[model samples]
Target: MELRVGTLNLASGRDGGGRSVDAAGLRAALADVDADVLAVQEVDVGQPRSHGVDQPAEVAAALGASDWRFAAAVTGTPDPFRSWTPVDPPVLRASWETLTGPHYGIALVSRLPVRRWSVLPLGAGRAKLPLQAPDPRTGETRWWWFPDEPRLAIAAELEHATVVSTHLSFAPHTALRQLTRLRRWCARLPGPVVLAGDLNLVGPVPARVFGAPRLVSEPSYPAPGPRVQFDHLLGRVAASRPEVRRLTIGDHRLVTVSVHPG
Candidate 1:
């Protein structure tokens, strides 16, 4: 069997202006790539910044995918500055009517049907990191300690293999711990497995921790001028050795890996 897997961070389905995505443009970009499965991170759901759009559904619809699943890392109303600075309004608090609907997280979309799915939440604990934020009294970008948010890994079981998608912590030590936990989790799944996502760690760190081989080694961050390879595709099955290529998709570099199984 042959499978093409792709991974990218959607950055909340926008081109960085908090403006709603151009559906036509997204559809065109996805159509240009040939992938059986796609793993996405930083997807938004019913959030006001994204114009209350369901990004996973939109991307799946754009690609004409048969199955897709979204796992929310943060379910409450988003604290805009707590995570990162937003392009538009910095805050959209959970109010009387909209308290429980808005969310942000990751997703997996597949052309092939999914037999089963699972989610694994990973993080050491909430910590804080210095992020540039607008001052409450005066609108000035100042370094503020933002809480390091927890993350989740979503997996889908297809006819041929299992695909796991995750976004790890930006902190190196924290990310290493999450990667270790992910490896242990993947060990129990059946058949060939491919782990794909933006790990936030560079070089051979992921391969070393996951005990898997990387499919490609191409820079895939800060799209305009990629300096590091954060997005990756790693395989655990001995029978599968995939070939990967990078594609420029909007603000992100989409990684596509072609797997030929024995």
Candidate 2:
């Protein structure tokens, strides 16, 4: 069986003018990918930034998926302007109180059949870190220090194999530890799993750090002129080369791969 999986970081659906693009624009951008399973990071839910669009729901609609989950990592926004609180006992959509602020985290959507779902929590990095962002006025890259929020990976049991989506910490050592933990977690799950996400690890470091084959290799960051590949799709299963494509919504490109399992 073959499964098409995609991973992308949604920058709150910003357009060329650095303005919000509603659900229609988001659907339009996803028209070509046609992934059976898609994992997205840096996602916003009930947030003013993306016009309060439930991004995961819209993305699931675009993919014609019936199973989807937005793994909420924080209760508030993580930008320099606002403070965020870690989500305790992270599972939601089961039974939980209304989130205090706009939620930001990673998500997973699947057009394929699902048996069960699971979430693995990776604690937040110890300190704030400088992240590069493009200046709104000049379009020049600028460094801004922002607090690190808690991280987690959402895994789904698909028909053919288990699938996982995650976003690791920007802190190098922390990310490395998370990767190791993630690898071990996947090892215990059902056989022939596909792990997809923005690992924040460069080049072959992620593969070497663990021992999974990275399905995609080309640089996917800074979409226009790529330099380093911070995005990855790793598994021991056979897979075709991914189509690393760019969207107007995010700084990083999306990677979609086709996995084959016997």
Question: What TM-score, computed on C-alpha atoms, does each candidate reach?
Answer: 0.81, 0.90
Best by TM-score: 2
Candidate 1 TM-score versus the reference: 0.81
**Sliding window of 10 residues with minimal summed lDDT for model 1:** 87-96
lDDT, candidates in the order shown: 0.71, 0.80
Which has the greatest lDDT?
2
Residues 1-262, candidate 2, lDDT per residue (tens digit)? 8899889988666665656578899888877667899988987777766777777777888888877888888765444523677778887441113444578788899887788889999887877777665432333446877777789999989877998999999898999999999989989888788888999999999988768888888899978888999989888888886799888777789889999977
- Total clashes for model 2: 0
lDDT of 2 at 229: 94
Whole-model alpha-carbon lDDT for candidate 2: 0.80
Which residue pairs clash in candidate 1? none
For model 1, what is the error of residue 235's alpha carbon versus the real structure, in angstroms, after optimal superposition? 0.6
